[model samples]
Target chain A: MRPTVHDIAAAAGVSLATVDRVLNRRPGVRHVTREKVENAIREIGYVRDVAAANLAKGRTYPLVFILPASDNSFMHGLNDEVRAAIARSSVERTAIRTLEVPAFDPAALVKVLNELGEERPAGIALVATDAPEVRDVVDRLVKDGIPVVTLVSDLTGSQRHHYAGVDNIAAGRTAARLLGRFLGGAKGEIAVLAGSMLVRDHRERLEGFAAVIAAEFPSLSILPVIEGRDDPEMAHMLVADALSKKGDIIGVYSLGAGNRGLIRALKEKAVDRSLTVVAHELTTHTRAALLDGTIDAILNQDAGHEVRSAIRVLKAKADGLAVIEAQERIRLDIFLKDNLP
Target chain B: MRPTVHDIAAAAGVSLATVDRVLNRRPGVRHVTREKVENAIREIGYVRDVAAANLAKGRTYPLVFILPASDNSFMHGLNDEVRAAIARSSVERTAIRTLEVPAFDPAALVKVLNELGEERPAGIALVATDAPEVRDVVDRLVKDGIPVVTLVSDLTGSQRHHYAGVDNIAAGRTAARLLGRFLGGAKGEIAVLAGSMLVRDHRERLEGFAAVIAAEFPSLSILPVIEGRDDPEMAHMLVADALSKKGDIIGVYSLGAGNRGLIRALKEKAVDRSLTVVAHELTTHTRAALLDGTIDAILNQDAGHEVRSAIRVLKAKADGLAVIEAQERIRLDIFLKDNLP
Candidate 1:
């Protein structure tokens, strides 16, 4: 039989009610008493019956998901996954709410995080901008006992408990290797389109891409990156302008969303199929373009997995439980038209 | 405020003890009395506080996962996901036990399913084979009040509560479109490598691939399918023999596992890198092959997502709850070396 609260109480030589309060992290328990109860729990190898314990406590994980308000397919997919999670909340017994701040607005996001601290939700999951204010907010949330998880874009050197997204550096290096080898030793200029340099994911991707290209394919040159802000019109204008200005451009890497604009630019120019086009995220637009030879390959991070991972981390934090790191590690998905899922 | 058991008992005009028995699904309450209590619960929209209720009852979900013993990367990935779930069992209040039977052995799989029924776990998740005996065994488990979910390959017309896999037909059609278009109106023979027609996923893939190739790329001829039983040596031998005999083969579609063999055959034969190759699953071998220009595109299903979906569905069904259909729907992932994750 599994060890129970009674065993913990006996081992700690504490009252049953006191043991319960300490186990639940409830108020009124002395620090020393709580430490004793925790030590007893560890000594006895007690695995709390989470379902039953939550039933007794009527616990509901109050989780907040912060995402960008960009209207690109990637953002849309992320929002849809979050909404799907919300729809399942009634059954999962979670109270999940999403907060959308403007894309690239670190100040607004920091403000929202500061406000959320007062509400004291069990956990917070956000796509962080690499800013001191955002990091400070995350640190405060952690200090206040709220677990913070970074989604999509990570905030390095913060108090965030976990990150639930793909490795951007690896993704970028993979993209560079693909482009270099696929062109069969051809020397040409490669153009890059990014959402913004401010976002860590985009910056990391560029850094990795450039490093690989410079190390492996010295013959190829990457032009200055065009910041599309992950907007279709901006991407389209920038790509078209680059193609016209640089007639020798032999490759294009759109490491951000707004692939709709990239596709439009490629189509308008009737870019040769041999140009080695690579983009991020597989949506209806990108999928069609891939089949039609407008795009050669796509790198994607499953939004659903990220959202689900965030919830699991949040719930575990809310319940004072440990999370399995291996399970929570999100993989970057690479897609070719032949292998589009 | 959430409704409590006391509210339910008072509303149902029953004693608290009677309400307790009904809420726990324990025996002793009359059929009519149970109906009254259930009706009260429904009218009040009272979702049992899962955490609190589980605490009071000391209930934990004992789940059994039945997977095929295949050494392919796909199966390995699926097993890894199950291991990840098992690692999470302590905190989630779930006891996960995995039972592996020989791959494609219907009798052995059926026997395991029957044995699982005897154990009477709260939930069972299995990759179903297309056999009536297997379906019958699953039906019996369902009848015994165990929530059963079909993982990866599903059993059609079975009493299983959920299927956590991609639509194989759509995956096949997409694969065909990619292959046909990538060939770019070139007239050539396409070789298809399959595991076996006995499996539903392989058969559906062939059907979808054939349908699209026939409709859109009539110029391309599909050669006879070579069944390698998803074994590397067999696939390698068959593919090498076919390449020797059919020198004009311009494309290859591998609709199942054993890609290691396919890669070996391609490399030994020194097949032209320009030949459009599409295969399923992005394993280490496929990823390397794609980067080296031996393979063009890969269609994939994330085994991790499928396994996680199976667990979520089983847990929800065991709780007598409905799942979010969109969230549970598995996606088809496409990968090219350029976009490899």
Candidate 2:
């Protein structure tokens, strides 16, 4: 039989109240008595049921998820996943609330971070707008004993407890490799579309893509990056303009979330020639594009996985517990039409 | 503050013992008293702390993981994942044990299943050896009210409660797509290697691969399958023989384990010409091979994810609770050298 609080009390020859005091780290217990209880706990091998203990003590984690107010399928999916967590908040003894900041607005994000630090939620998980001020505020929050985790877009130099996302650089390299190999020695230019250069994920992805193409596929040339701001119409316009200018463009790599625009442009230029395309995220648009043979492949990070991973990391951090690193590492998922789930 | 057992006791005007009896579903509780206690529980909106409640009731799920005693990287990895679960068993309120049966021995597997059914574990998760007798045993166990989940390789047409693995048919189709795209109009024979035709996963994968190749890439002729029985040495011999006989083999799709043998044969060939190879699972050998350009792509279902998902499903089934279907859907992961992790 497993040991319990009563077992520890009996083993230490102390009153149940004194045992509870020591277990809960309550004040006013004598040092020797506390040590006795601790030793008894060790001897009896009492693995505390943390959830039950928290319930008995009437403790609930107040967590805040800060997401970007971006009208994209991926962002919408992330929000839905967060809401799913909220549905289970009562059972988990957590009070989770979401705060949306304007997309790509670093100053507004910094201001929000400062406010949250003052409010002092038990934990905070944010899709960060990477900036020095934002990093400073994150550091300050950590210094004040609140656990902070970066969501999809990570803050590289910040003192964040964990990152609940994929390795963007590797994702970019994978994209390049896919596009390069899919082209199969065809000599033509490749067009690149991204959300923004300001975001670390996009920048890192571009870096990786450029590095791999330079090292491996010297035959293919990458055109100037078109920033879509994750807006589909903007992406559509940029892609259409580029495609029209460079009629010999053999491939397209979209390392951002404005796939609707990219898809529209591709459909408009629906010629008999095969154009290799790779994009990020699996949304309704991307899925259809893949099915119709427009997009060759998609590199996705599951929004649900990211959101769930964030909650688990934040909870573990709040409780000073070690997380399963392998379980928490959000995979860079590559999808073909055949493997779409 | 949230309601506790004490709140329920007071609200129902009953003793703590009465409340405990009702909550734990213990015997000797009067119907009217039970109703009053349940009413109090509903009125207060008390979310039962299942972990704590189980602790109080001394409930621990005894689960068995039946794996194949195959000396292959994937099987070893699966066993390691099950061991990882066992490491957390104490804290998770589970008693997990593993039983290994000889690889590909359906009769032995059926015998083991019959014995386990008699032993009457709370739950069972097995890498099923597909056979009618095995299916019968699974049905018998389920009839005896024990929850069973098929892990890794599923037992189709069985009474297994859940399958914690990827869709192998889709995996196969994805492999064909990758190989077809990578080969890009090259007119040469493609080699197919599998673990065994007896297993459902292997059969399904072959079916999918064949269907996709026939429908899409008619230029590439498929050579007859070579069954390695997931043995590396056997796979090496068969691949070497096939390579010698078919010098014009342009691409190879290995839909099962024993990649070590396949890698050895490829290394021995040392051809200047490129052989576009696709395989299943990501092991050290496969990772190194991918980096060195021996393998083009890898289709994997995370063994860790499968084991964990199976445990969650088994536990939920045992408790007659609903599972989050989306969360439990194991993704068919595609890996390139750039995205090895």
Candidate 3:
């Protein structure tokens, strides 16, 4: 039998109402009393019966998902997946609202997080910008007893309860191995195009890629990173500029969202499609490029899976239960044109 | 705003006790009374409040998962995921039991299904074999009011409520496009290795692969299909034989499991890793092969996701509620060594 609220209350030598206030983070509980209740909960390992408790309390978790206001195919696909989740919210007894923030703007993200903290939804799921101010806001939300989960891009060293995305380091290492091997151990230059160095995902990917290339494929030399900001025009210009500057490029790794610019650059440069090209995410643009031989492989993290995972984690945290870790851990997906799903 | 059992009973002109018996399938209600109550339920669209109803009745859904007894890494990973779910059963208020049947044996699968029918678990999840006998057994279970869901390999024309697996047709098409483009559009013969044509997944993959090859890359010729039955030794022997006989084979697509054999054959033949080879599932063998250059791309369906999805669908069905289709749809994960999670 699992311990319940009554057990925690009894163990803490407190009333059931007091325990409820502390557990739900309702007002009117003293700091000492709240600490006692939390201690008792930890000691007893009292996992709240989410489904049953929510039924008795009539609590529907109100969750907000914040994403970038980008019009790229990947962003549109992500928005679609979130909308699909919203449509199913009624059945799951959840109230989900989506908020859009400007891409790569720390001030905007921090403001949104602060506003969300004031509203105090049961939980917040956001694609975070890697900035100290944004991290502070996320910490404030957690301190205020709201569960925060990072989706896609994560903010490190925050009080966020979970990250519902892939391991970017592993994804990058995998890409380097593929590119190095596909190039047949040839000595050549590899070009990397990324959204931005400020984003944690991109940095981690570059780190992993560089680590693998240095350790395993000493023959290939990687050029300085190109910042595309995940904009097609920027990516095209940067890639084209790099190709013109260094004509010996044998491989390209786009560890960012937008691939349209990269595809356009490759086509315009008339770079042989046989040159190993690996990019991140599978959208309409990437899919078409992959099929047409412009893009070789794609590293993807399923948006639908990530959205669903966020909801599950938020609901679990709101109900004061531990999530199944293995089930919640999102995987890095690799796609070739042969294996596109 | 949802209708309750009382509304159903009132609309059916039946007593609450009779309605309960009919709703729970307790075997006491007369046929005419059951029909009337069911009709009323259909008219009212009275979706049972699963959480509240379970709490009131103190009912825990007992779900049985039937898996293959193969001792491969993929199967082990699937089993591990299922076990993780089972460990959370107490907290989730579910009773999950796992039953393993001999791999590729329809007789054993049918026998197990019959036994599950006799045991009458609240729900059953099976990795189906494409056999009529197994389908009949599944139909019998569904007829007896037990919800059955197919995992991984689906049983066509059966009364399975859902398929918690990737679309194999799409997977095949994706593989063909990848292989064709990866080979640089060179007109050469491609060999397809499968577990067995008797399995619906393999057949669907072959169909899709053929469709794409015929429609898009008419220059690439497909060699006769080789059935390895998902065994390492058979795959090794068959692939080696095929390679020896067909000297001009430019690409190979292994749509089934047992990639260990495929890797062995490639290594034995001293075939250059540059030859386009696409296989399914990212086990240790396939991952290492991919990294070392023996395997070009992996078309994977995350075994963990499949197991978890099966459990969710089963629980939802047992509760007499609709599942979120998009949330439950398993993705075909494309993996390269560079993008492996």
- Candidate number with greatest lDDT: 2
Question: What stretches of model 3 exceed 4 Å from their correct place?
Answer: A1-47, A115-119, A169-198, A202-279, A285-297, A337-341, B1-48, B115-119, B143-145, B169-279, B285-297
**For this target, which candidate reaches the highest DockQ against the unseen true structure?**
2
lDDT of 1 by residue, B202-313 (tens): 9999998999899889999999999988999999999999988887898999999999999999998855545788899889999999888788778888787787788878
For model 1, the docking class works out as acceptable
Model 1: lDDT of residue B76: 88
lDDT of 3 by residue, B242-333 (tens): 88887788899999887899999999884553478989898889999988878888888877778778877888887777777866878787
Across residues B1-341, which tens digit of lDDT does each residue of candidate 2 receive? 55789999999999999998998789999899999999999999877766666757678899999999988899899999999999898778889999999977889988888899788888999998888888888998998999999998888699889999999999999999899989888899999999989888999999999999999999999999999989999999999999988879999999999999999999887466689999999999998999999999988889999999999999888777678898899989888889888
Chain B TM-score, candidates in order: 0.94, 0.90, 0.84
Q: For each candidate, C-alpha RMSD in Å? A: 5.0, 3.1, 6.0
TM-score of decoy 1: 0.79
Name the candidate, 1 or 3, with the larger TM-score value. Answer: 1
Tens digit of lDDT per residue, candidate 2, span A18-44?
998987779989999999999999998
Residue A179: error of model 2 in Å? 0.6
Of 1 and 2, the candidate ranking higher by DockQ = 2
**lDDT over C-alpha atoms for residue A123 of model 3:** 90
**Where is the poorest 10-residue window by lDDT in model 3 chain B?**
B267-276
* Clashes per candidate, residues 3 or more apart or on different chains: 23, 0, 8
